[model samples]
Target chain A: MSSKSNDKDLGVRKIIYDKDGKPCRSCNTLQDFQFATGKISAKDIQHIKNGTEIAAASPQETILNSKAYRRVDPPGVEELGRSSWNLLHSITAKYPKSPSDEQKLEMKQFLTIFSHVYPCNWCASDFEKFIKVKAPKLNSREEFGRWMCEAHNEVNAKLKKEQFNCDFWEKRWKDGWED
Target chain B: MSSKSNDKDLGVRKIIYDKDGKPCRSCNTLQDFQFATGKISAKDIQHIKNGTEIAAASPQETILNSKAYRRVDPPGVEELGRSSWNLLHSITAKYPKSPSDEQKLEMKQFLTIFSHVYPCNWCASDFEKFIKVKAPKLNSREEFGRWMCEAHNEVNAKLKKEQFNCDFWEKRWKDGWED
Candidate 1:
């Protein structure tokens, strides 16, 4: 077996077959995805609904309730922030462009990393309480971003004079810091 | 708000906690795992390392590669096959069993599922492929279970003929049968 590489370079490859392996629902074309050389990843028949074609009657194809999901590789520690950022941006999309998608994404990214070290349920009420009291309910992405920045300050204020762990901070702050 | 029902009847609640807010790893005291309903799910405070004491470590106390690992939930209608089964089982300790003890706990219950699903690779190939080809070794749980039962013929043989969705099977079987 080859030695595992770090997050920066996870070598991956694809498997090809004569007949299209998976067909897309819309055009009945093949679904495009990658596979690791020796590893197998999950595949989805593109655009299929609940074992049926998506009719206007079915608003959403299917909502997978399980918290578990699979991808090509085990998620990299560095990738967590980015994944969380995408999640936040998606959730913020529900509310009118209030919290700019970019800022909301940042807050979710930061919290994902924070939860790693802090060991708190991201959705736990106590944590939610901390946010609700310390930060107003974020109406927009900018407001959410401001809240997170403030939370960072609060943490540093307690460590007063002692700088926050730069390495830890850097890992979470994937995109360049605004301030 | 509805009071906590006896989930024990449902085979859902396995772990128990005493606190009303959240499980505090530091004190090993009972805490509410959920805030809205003040209900806690059954959980074991797994020392990222199974045998180590959480407190001995200075900065890293909780699960290593600390992240929220939501428990694997039951599969849905669409997730009934080999790929989804392997993906679902991979997350929980009940499915895969690791080859070595030194590997991460996540590796523990996964060996079985891994062996089975490794060859299938997103359902591209099933266990029957390995059996017929007499190549590509299979030994893990996934191999034994998924490949042997569902992928092979064990599952099909065991199922009552009535359980077979003849219409579905007829539609998918050899090209001539479908036409």
Candidate 2:
């Protein structure tokens, strides 16, 4: 095999193809992979077919080589999940102990809008379903905290991760554990 | 100094007190420091006061001792910022080039609610002011992307970080660089 073909073994391109041999762009992790190598640039495609190894660098490696690479790269689903959870739990921790009616309404509205706009399409859809089934409890801080903890546990279950101890919700997020 | 008092020198407790000597829970990094040593449990408080260094251990250390410590801890502000940026940019990258009117409305509503409910109180309030002055442009993907980049640059300027090149927004977020 040519060095260009050998580059596929490096686990860079996992291009899934349909029966007609067309690349399924959605199946690719790096969205622009097709555009980077597709018909727009026949010369580049020819370079690849000519067995040139230079055309085989992974999208990530190509990005890393860019001068602006140090600025910041877009976060994947996992990173988004972690950051979102941190923001959510912190908000719960700071929630008022005896919230007013208006405060409760605002909190509920916030959650509704959050579900609608959450960047991850699949995750957001799942969360919308979850919240619709079991609406958020915004009565008091303790109730809200526990409700949020259980919601998180639901996500953990879906992700096949271990469920957190809900009893220690405050201890973990708000108050530190008593050693 | 006794071991209990010595715990103070360990920099374990970074408590902030108000004018009345009451611990300002909001000002403290780790909550429950006062509660762990306060009068609610004289036995626990006395245990701390009686030169028992073990009783004075912070929750962070206690968590670090746990097996799940490596799994995840609450993200700090910087980590949260990085992850949030990632999610926002990725969403922008995936946004429809010629979005429907309904899509534009949803995006605007999402931003409004997001600004209000952003976990960081100060950051959220600041963002609220920002959106009010410079409303989100949802006419096209390019307009939205450039607007988002400029908003991020505003934040970067405030944080004294280098501004990103908006011209390369698509290249950095949607497409891999041309090597």
Candidate 3:
């Protein structure tokens, strides 16, 4: 195909490759994964054009958001992104104050495996990079929570969202204001 | 506390205790966490009374649904439940068929840690029980996916929701119908 046709075919999508160098739908939510692969609905296209909110339309009640990272019928990028953060953050929020060495080691292993098995290859690598910059602080809940907050804030900044004050990490994650 | 007052305070919520036996907000969304602890808005109370759809009130973008697990501010049981399944199911959906022994072991280890660090102690224990009943089958993607689907379906059944057709697991998770 001509370069122009290829560009036309791709539209605004940036193809992310999988282990086999094929377009990885799990990796690319918008470009290569969602629209390029014909996963997005016409309504989604309208939302993208108008910058409107995209609705997550999974009827399986998860499959609860089970396929969030895979297909539009199931979830797609936004749902996966939304849900993964929830699971990851909550896991850290509940980390023990003084985790045992084995616990710490397991946490490390979990993150490593998590980064590998995460459906979105590109996202998995990003998480790996995020962990590398400042390794998981497993000494105490406070230390680990702080590390996790900073890492999340970095992600927030990248997404152009407001950064949460890390000081309230406990209140935000573990305790509500009433506590 | 008077038994009558205690019951009144408990409201329609079922308090699920943590490891310490204290009311685990992580486990009980309605009883101990969201409303009993005063996390729910007055509007939420009205909705509860009216049986309307409950809104997940987190403007944090994520903390993409992170605190969906631990707190109502970020997310709550509903958010957490929805997201966890998404993350778990997608991971399984993407599992490498004929995975190396190392991958299977890692997946198993991942589940063990996942259950351990899971914020909701009740849910975590329940997940452990689920595993005990039908251990994870890791030989192939289909086997693993089928096992995961059955597990999720069991959860759905418990929640009084419809069971997913296991045959459609791949279609629902990895590929949309158009493909």
Best-matching candidate per DockQ = 3
Candidate 1 wrongly placed segments (more than 4 Å): A1-30, A33-179, B1-84, B88-179
- Give the alpha carbon lDDT tens digit for every residue of B1-179 in model 1: 13246534323322332233422221111222221123333332233224434332112232224343122211211223333332222222122233233222323223332333221122323333434454322334334233323333433353332222322221112111111
lDDT of 2 by residue, B1-179 (tens): 11234445444344444344554333333323344346234344455556654443343443333444322334434555665666567667656788888888878876786676565455676789999999998888888888888888899888777677788787666553644
Query: How does each model score on lDDT?
Result: 0.29, 0.62, 0.70
Better of 1 and 3 by DockQ: 3
DockQ of all candidates, in order?
A: 0.02, 0.22, 0.41
Give the top-scoring candidate (lDDT). Answer: 3
DockQ, 0 to 1 scale, candidate 1:
0.02
Q: Per-residue lDDT of A1-179 in model 3, one digit per residue for the tens?
A: 11223444334445566665555656666433555555555557667678787765432343333443233355566678878877777777788888999999988998888988898877787889988887888888888878878887887787677776777777776665442
Candidate 3 deviant stretches above 4 angstroms: A1-13, A19-22, A30-32, A39-47, A51-72, A157-162, B1-11, B19-22, B30-32, B39-47, B51-72
Rank the models by TM-score, top first. Answer: 3, 2, 1
The digit string of per-residue lDDT tens for model 2 on A1-179 reads 11234335333344444233544222243322343345234444445556664543444542333444443334545666776777677678767888888778878877876676565656777889988999999988899989999999999888778677777787766654544
Q: For each candidate, how many residue pairs have backbone atoms clashing (under 3 Å)? A: 21, 0, 8
Give all TM-scores, in the order shown.
Answer: 0.20, 0.64, 0.77
